[model samples]
Target: MWSGELLDLDAYLARIGYDGPVGEDGELRPDLGTLYAVHRAHTGAIAFENLDVLLGRPVELGVKALEDKLVHGRRGGYCYEQNSLLAAALERIGFEVSGRGARNRTRGDTLLAVTHAVLVVTVDGEPWLCDAGFGHQGPREPVPLARPGAEVVQGEWTYAVREEEEGILALSILREGIWRDLYAFSPQRYHPVDYVLLNHYSSTHPRSVFVARVIVQHPGDSVHHPVRRALVGRELNRLHADGRVERRSVEPDELLALLDREFGLRLSGRDAEELVRINRAGD
Candidate 1:
């Protein structure tokens, strides 16, 4: 259902630097190990950003569109683009992948619309929560859906799936000794068309944060003690493994360099100029 056939699977595998998970038959395996390897590789190699929204461009969700922009273009994306690309790769490899719409929980107790997109991959009779979006504070690997409240540690970060009200499950992270909710989703499966509508709001609506400011995130650089980085508007926040946050103002002149040097996001000359104009306008 993710339109995997349209994706350049070889390019995606190489883009993420995932070398081998192929079985003895010289075919990609659809096992839990491959799932973990691909998930980690994708999250590490790619970044999470809303640059298109900030650039007044539409956020496309089709597999080929995703491949052209995210994989081939070497650009980072937010929820829909990130997860949909992931779903396609896994589905192409013969994994049973499904989509889900989730609500943002990090923005305090306020209830928000269901705009975020995630994927559920079923492997060997077990389902796992797989997301490459949600920015720096997000998980790098799949968290077990079968084991509620059990923490799955990825590098220096730890994550768990907690059962919320009704049939919904909330993904929580242990930060500063507290289980902070990242985002929550119900069992209601989502389709690409569903995300098209959500993307409309997130990309164009005046109330959407993505349309209002710049957002770029990556899990971290190191495997053992990764430092999660997030750039929101003019402020750059770096969250250390031990729960320390070091934030600084990003000047317009230094914005592009920060994105490339720290987040691995490099835009073309024209796009870079436009981004700088947008950055200056935001201030």
Candidate 2:
């Protein structure tokens, strides 16, 4: 049973600039077609961002709130907001979408404690993992859940599914030929409130990377810097766009300025100096 309102399929598609009607089979549409549609909606319309933290706004998990942000505000959100919103939309369109959570092992065992969100969909009797809310764009193809060899390639990221311990499944990705942890979760039941707790920690906890820095995604690339003003060494840093990766030092004020000029983000109530101090310590 759906927890909230049934999403308006036409309006949702319109929100993302799709003029076509929802197919009769609902979300069992052509896999490649659906993948393209999702990509277009996510990349062309929404602005992947993290301005809420800077503006002192709590990231809410309600469907209405997510619709307001994604459809009205024309913004991109973190995992909780993104995956929940996508799941709701898919459900309305007739896809068997479920809200699931995962552990982000890439950040280390300590950071792995928090639960992250993902969406699962079934198409043509096959389980497909779909995530348009991830900061980077999604795979050009749907990731088959039942097959060990299922894979999708997008630029430098190759995503695949593999069985993990205790019969639980894992989602692994190859970044530059090295397999790394993206997230891990199963079909265990989940609720919006469950995400609220993790969302709070991700946005406010002293140890959260988002609390210490700001991240903004542009059309074809993204930029990350400490939320405060201090300089922290980037674990893996590369700025690529227009066929080149520019390695440059971004100052506190300049970072703020770029937030407005490039990413269409205008922040308020954020203490830039404080952020810098926190960032310096992490560095």
Candidate 3:
């Protein structure tokens, strides 16, 4: 049904080391479950970061661009880049996946516009939210699109759903049970160009975190590693095994090593040097 040649699911899965599937009920099974598997595989596999921005590269949405960046480059991506690649992977695996746009509530009024490129997948005739691009603080499992108050806790963060007007859904997380809006999304169909617009805003806007700072996220077996950089300096925080907080400052050169060693994002030595320079300047 797709116009382009379909992606190879096995190869894609193998590239990311995903082996999960869906069950007979059409829900995501342990081996090949669609939404659950996407979450499990994504958090377990791809990291969330803005290295492209730090490296002064453009983030594109075309399929080849995604494959080249994700599979070939072996790097992590933010929402549009990661989710777009994921949609292709889901489509290849025989799941009905569609692209959707969202507004980042965290940025509030500062951001020039909303962000695009999340996925909605159907499993057992039900829709589930599967996003792997929201960094370390995204949903750990596929959440039901229609279920309000549904929650999933990953490490210290807990994701919950709330319904809003106009058929929109707000995804929130309890940072100590206080609801924080992650983003508001609708199950609307979006063209790749729609994502291009949002991508441009995120990458170019003055107030955007993408342009203003460096963001990194890598997930472990039971913890999440997140770091942020701004004029105030860089902050490195870890979501520990027992859900404790740990914060520290890492050297700029060390940041590159952390990305590769801890987060599994490999960069060339030149890229690493550039990242260190940019991060140092931001400090």
**What does candidate 2's lDDT look like per residue over 1-283, in tens digits?**
3343555555567766763334676543545457446644644455555556645678877787887777776666777777777777666555676667777766666556746777777777777777655554333335778886566564444678887777566777665456666677866866667778888888888877666555555333311221111122332224332223434566554655655555454444545555444434544
The prediction achieving the highest TM-score against the true structure is: 1
How well does model 2 score by local distance difference test? 0.59
Task: Estimate, for each residue in 156-222, the C-alpha lDDT of model 1 and write its tens digit.
Answer: 7889999977989999999989989999999999998888899899999999999988999998654
Q: Relative to the unseen true structure, what is the Cα RMSD of model 2?
A: 5.8
lDDT for position 25 in model 2: 65
Ranking by TM-score: 1, 3, 2
> In candidate 1, where is summed lDDT lowest over 10 consecutive residues?
219-228
Error in Å for residue 224 of model 1: 2.5
Backbone clashes for every candidate come to 0, 8, 12
> What is the TM-score of each predicted model, taking all chains together?
0.97, 0.73, 0.83
| Candidates' RMSD to native | 1.1, 5.8, 4.1
Q: Considering lDDT, where higher is better, how would the candidates rank from best to worst? A: 1, 3, 2
